[model samples]
Target: MTNTADHGRVRDSYDVVAQEYRDRIGGELAHKPVDRALLGAVVEAAAGGPVADLGCGPGHVAGWLTAHGAEVVGIDLSPAMVEIARREHPGAEFREGDLLRLPATDGEFAAAVALYSVIHLDPAELAPAFTELRRVLRPSGSLLVSFHIGTEVRRLDEWWGHEVDVDFHFLQPDVVAGLLTGAGFTVEARLEREPLPEEAETRRCYLLARRD
Candidate 1:
């Protein structure tokens, strides 16, 4: 179960750092060839259908998808983040929403991407989150998720000089895959990579799944 208080903290923290976060991480895809490649695959899989960028901070991922010919909607928990995303990436739609209970209709998207976004969720919340993702996706829709690979929770009291509270929960790929499977998604592909020099020193895991 997702703690409402924790969710509020996460939202507030992101709201506090929304601008700085966008300035720093907005253009990250330019340096990540693998991430760009996977995102391209997502665009192709969508076949011009609308794609959902879940946990889309500043709308960078959604913007990239829109630039690549996919219709996109970006969803974030922070209203400030959504505002920045809308202002920065006018081509894609941005909305303030939670992962556990998305503000979208059932089967509303042909594909969805949740890059490094699920890390904010508690381990027990993963199943429900994935189930919600599946609920919003069309049958056989593609889903891509990425997160830090570990079994630890890293809490932050401050970010970019702003006082805040947030917890980033590292996860095991196998456990995530199992949770996805239990949520009615079929695991398709998995990739693990070392962090780039500019990124935090942690291994990252990406999982591609299809709604069934």
Candidate 2:
């Protein structure tokens, strides 16, 4: 697989710290069975049908979708993660691509999911990303996303123990809902709860949006 060097940068970042990421966020973000059940519900609810795990890293959700008989593709910015995904989950299609420029036709998906994926993108960056998600989702498609919500913006001074250059952005519930609405995703479900981390003062927000 030819790696776009730009894609290579993401690959390197993840490669440099893959184990660290897996350790830190992996357990905290572990929702394999529960996520599968919820995602299945979203797929069954959508008239267009099928679903995608947007920004799918290591292809966990994509693997579950495949097992559940959904036409699924896992997309991620990191080529290393993509490689690992393809290796680990042979049946699922794992592509190295940006969320902003999704490689799909308009209304191509019945659902789009991003679990703790947008934590790396700021509001400005996320607006266009949401636009892509909305663009590909069928009219009745739903988007379920989770992110670390906070009152203050946390610049990514580092990621998973690596001194990374990328900036990470956290959002409050209102701002996230506004972005979803602006991007043509009808905000249907929004929930806030305390994060699992003891030091985490912020809440974990879940948004379920459908195309309008």
Candidate 3:
């Protein structure tokens, strides 16, 4: 079961930093060629079907996907984030929702992307989160998930000069892959890469899976 208190903290913290976070991180994909390539692959695999951008912050990824010819719906935990996403990326849809209990119908999305979003969930919450993701995706639909690669939980008491409480959980690639498998997904591709120079120093992992 997911901790509701922790979810509240995360939602409030993100609401506090929504605009600042958008201004600083909105243009990240431009410098990331690999990320662009993978996103393009997702767009192609979606095959003109709607793609859900799970935990989409500021709608940048969803905007990028929209620009690349994919229908997108961006979901975030923070209402402020959703507002900013709607204002900034008018081309795509944005909604406030939780990962553990998404506001989506079963098999609704043809493909989904959860970039650096699951890092907020506790270890025990991960399996349920993945299961929820699987529940929304159509059979054979693709899922791309990215996270920091490690076994540490970094908590932030303050961010961007604002009082906030949130935790970022690093996870092992193998462990995440196994959890996806347990959630009825077939692991397809796993990629690990060092962070870009302008980004944080943490190594990152990306897993591509297919709903079975």
| lDDT of each candidate versus the true structure | 0.95, 0.71, 0.95
Candidate 2 residue runs with Cα over 4 Å from true position: 1-12, 19-37, 46-48, 155-163, 197-202
Candidate RMSDs in order: 0.8, 4.1, 0.7
* lDDT, candidate 3, at 92: 98
Each prediction's TM-score against the native?
0.99, 0.81, 0.99
| Model 2 Cα lDDT, one tens digit per residue, 1-212 | 22245344454566666556644544432544445566776757654366778777777678766767777878888776777778867987877777777777788788888887877664567788888888888887889988877755654436756765444457777888898899887888876666444335666778888888
**Sequence-dependent TM-score of model 1:** 0.99
Model 1, global lDDT: 0.95
Query: Model 1, residue 87: what's the lDDT?
Result: 96
Among all windows of 10 consecutive residues in model 3, the one with the lowest summed lDDT is: 1-10
Runs in model 3 lying further than 4 Å from the true structure: none
Candidate 2 RMSD to the real structure: 4.1
Pairs clashing within candidate 1: none
For 61-124, candidate 3 gives per-residue lDDT tens digits of 9999999999999999999999999999999999899999999999999999999999999999
**Residue-wise lDDT of candidate 1 within 114-210, one digit each (tens)?**
9999999988899999999999999999999999999999999988899999999999999999999999999999999999997999999999999
> Candidate 3 versus the native: TM-score?
0.99
